[model samples]
Target: MTDTLATAEIESTIRSLEDARYAAVVAGDIEGFAAFAHPELLYTHSNAAVDTLDSYLEKLRTGFYVYHRIDHPVHKIVVVGDTVLVSGEMRADITAGGVRKQLANSALAVWVRDGGRWLLLGYGPTVIPGAI
Candidate 1:
């Protein structure tokens, strides 16, 4: 396939992965999270808090964050070598550590192709000014 065609295909696949990963949050599916997350994932929240794979999973497992909704309006997706860089807007509602929150964020996620699958390596979001 042409490069452009390949890129489009990869983009679509990555978007599907993102959807599934986010769905896991709403479903509170631990195994689903594990399936999508890389072993070395570093998820940085809009508030600047960071979570490694283990800690992030614990956050869900212990009900520290109960995500009821997650929506990403992806602006850009690029494939560089074996990595896909995703830039997007994040809008979500969640109860974090038992406190309700509505999050509006500018987000980026790095997905690395591992073996035959895409693994989410990192996620970082900054709160959009005046968008909470």
Candidate 2:
């Protein structure tokens, strides 16, 4: 395949994975979400709190973080070597630490190819101006 074709394929796969991951979160499927996560995943919230894979899973398992809805519109996907960077904006209704909130943020997700599969290595979101 040509380089362009290969990149497009990777982009498509990563996009699908992103969608599935968001769906898992909204559905409260810890295991499903875990399937896409790297062992050393670092998830950073817009509030600047960071969670390791274990902590994030625990929050999901215990309902400490409850995702009621998420609308993530990916703007770009860039492939470099075995890594993919996804850029997007996310708007969501969620409850964190027992407090309900709506969120609007610009998000970045990093996925790395490991052991012949793609796993999410890190994710971070920054609150959009005047959006919460």
Candidate 3:
């Protein structure tokens, strides 16, 4: 396939996966979210707290982190061989550690092709100024 075509295909797949990920979080589907998560995933929150995949999942399962809704608008996607970098902004309504909050964040998500599937390797989100 041509480079352009390959890129398009990759972008589409990544976009779908991203959408599904958010949906899973909103729906409190831990297993669904886990399907896309890499074992060594590193997730850094807007508050600068970090979680590995296991910890993140545990939090989700225990209701320590609950997502009510998420609006994520992807700004860019760069495919570098088997790795993909996604730049986006996320606006979310969530409850973290029993405190409800609305968050607007500039988010970066890294996905890596593993075997025949793509897995979320890392994610970091920065709080947007005055967006709380």
Candidate 4:
């Protein structure tokens, strides 16, 4: 395939993955989360810490972390060879231990093709002071 075509395809797939991430967070569906994530997925947070998808799912299964709402506004997408990078602003409302709060963030995600499907390889975001 031509480089342009490949880039387009990768960008589209990255957007789709973002949608899935939103859906899973909204529904709090661990099953949906599992479906979209690769077993060996490496996701890094804005805090500079990294966690595997499996480890993330395990934490979810514990029912300890609950997110009430999540919204992501994409700002950019760039594709290079088999890798796609997405940058966006994120707003989230979360409640845990009876404390509910809002969070604003800027996110960057890296996605790569695994066989025929796209899997998120890395994601990092900085917490912004206010909504974007």
RMSD after CA superposition, every candidate? 0.8, 0.7, 0.6, 2.4
**Local accuracy of candidate 4 as per-residue lDDT tens digits, 60-124:** 66654477888898999988766778999777877643567776889988777778777777777
Per-candidate Cα lDDT values, in order, are: 0.93, 0.97, 0.97, 0.76
| Pairs with backbone N, CA or C atoms under 3 Å apart (clashes), candidate 1 | none
lDDT value for candidate 1?
0.93
Error of 3 at 103 (Å): 0.4
Estimate, for each residue in 1-132, the C-alpha lDDT of model 2 and write its tens digit.
Answer: 999999999999999999999999999999999999999999999999999999999999999999999999999999999999999998999999999999999999999999999999999999999875
lDDT of 1 at 40: 95
Give the per-residue Cα lDDT of candidate 1 at 24: 90
For candidate 3, lDDT tens digit of each residue in 1-132?
A: 999999999999999999999999999999999999999999999989999999999999999999999999999999999999999999999999999999999999999999989999999999999977
After superposing all C-alphas onto the true structure, candidate 1 shows an RMSD in angstroms of 0.8
Candidate 3 Cα outliers beyond 4 Å, as residue runs = none
lDDT of residue 57 for candidate 4: 72
TM-score of each: 0.97, 0.98, 0.98, 0.83
Lowest-scoring 10 consecutive residues by lDDT in candidate 3? 123-132
* Shift of residue 6 alpha carbon in model 4, Å: 3.6
Question: What is the C-alpha lDDT profile of model 1 across 1-132, one tens digit per residue?
Answer: 899998899999999998899889899998898899999999999889999999999999999999999888999998997899999988999999899999999999999999988999999998999986
